[model samples]
Target: MTDLVRARLRTTVLLIVAVLVETTLGSDLRIAGVAPDFMILVVICAGLTGGTLSGAFVGFWAGLLYDMFLTATPVGLSALTYCLIGAAIGALRTSVLQERKSLLPAAALIGTAAGVLLFVGAGDVLGQTQLLGAGRAWLIRVMIVESLWNAVLALPVGYVYAWVARGSAGAERVGSPVRRTSRSAVPTVK
Candidate 1:
């Protein structure tokens, strides 16, 4: 099969696996009371590698799936939050941001934090109001811990994501060494 076709298939399957793990294994493997936010990681990866449409599409569906399984809030809230996060991160891929040192991990860290904040903020606005629930101290603690969790997860998740994309696209299967006619031959731009 073609690389593109393989990528699409892999991406779909990955999303399913992410959701399954999020609902099932996530609870079993919680450090304290927080899960790995696998769906968020997947969405971030999609945005980084697949562009806005892929990110938004995957984010919407993934978040919706999570929302459906969740007992806490309304269904569309997470969906909307992920949609925005995916779009924003995917848009950033077009700039010099990705080339900077530590850009990918930084993006993941920032994106994850933003995503969580947006989720809670939306819940608060929609009258879910978990932001103020359990008092200010608990809320701050949750934020700090979750942020740290996300930061810890960012690098490995991003690596896996890049690997998945490259593998699916067949970009990583073979190295192409350009034949040089001179000492400093630059390949022509497409």
Candidate 2:
């Protein structure tokens, strides 16, 4: 199979597995009254590893899958939030962030925190007052705890995402190699 096809296939499998795991064991793996948002973590990892478009695509589908399980909120809320977060994270990685051992967890930490705020803010604006019914303090707590949880899980998920995204357009961009032309090939300025 072509590399692009293989990469896309792997991506499909990864998303399916992630959604299954998140839906099944995610709640059971709570810490400090907060469950790890594995779906969001996957989206963040995709962004950090695969670049902006990759992240946005993955985030949209993943968020849509997550939305299927939520009856309280409107259908597209999670999709919008995850899609934006993924795209933002990807853009940041492309423009400013460097490849490093700590990049995954750091992105997850910050992305999740921002994502929580965005989700709540957008939900409130969409007439989902229940998101803000608990007040700012509750929101803050959820943000801190969930961000931490996602950060803790980022490394493993990132590695998996990198493997799954192998050979895809964005996968090849991570830790992009700097092109170096030989000095001898340069024309002399006589």
The per-model lDDT (C-alpha) reads 0.66, 0.79
Candidate 1 per-residue lDDT over residues 1-190, each given as its tens digit: 8766676677677778888877897677666666667788778767755556667877898898888888878989889989888777766654334344355556667788788778888889999886568776765565666666766776666665555555442222111211112212211111
- lDDT string, candidate 2, 18-131, tens digits: 889988899898777778899998888778666678778889998898899899999989999999998898888767776566677888899999999999999999999999
Identify the candidate with maximal TM-score.
2
Number of colliding residue pairs in each model: 0, 0
User: Can you tell me which runs of candidate 2 are displaced by over 4 Å?
Assistant: 169-190
Worst 10 contiguous positions by lDDT, candidate 1: 181-190
TM-score of each: 0.77, 0.87
lDDT (C-alpha) at residue 71 in model 2 = 90
Q: What is the RMSD of candidate 1?
A: 6.3
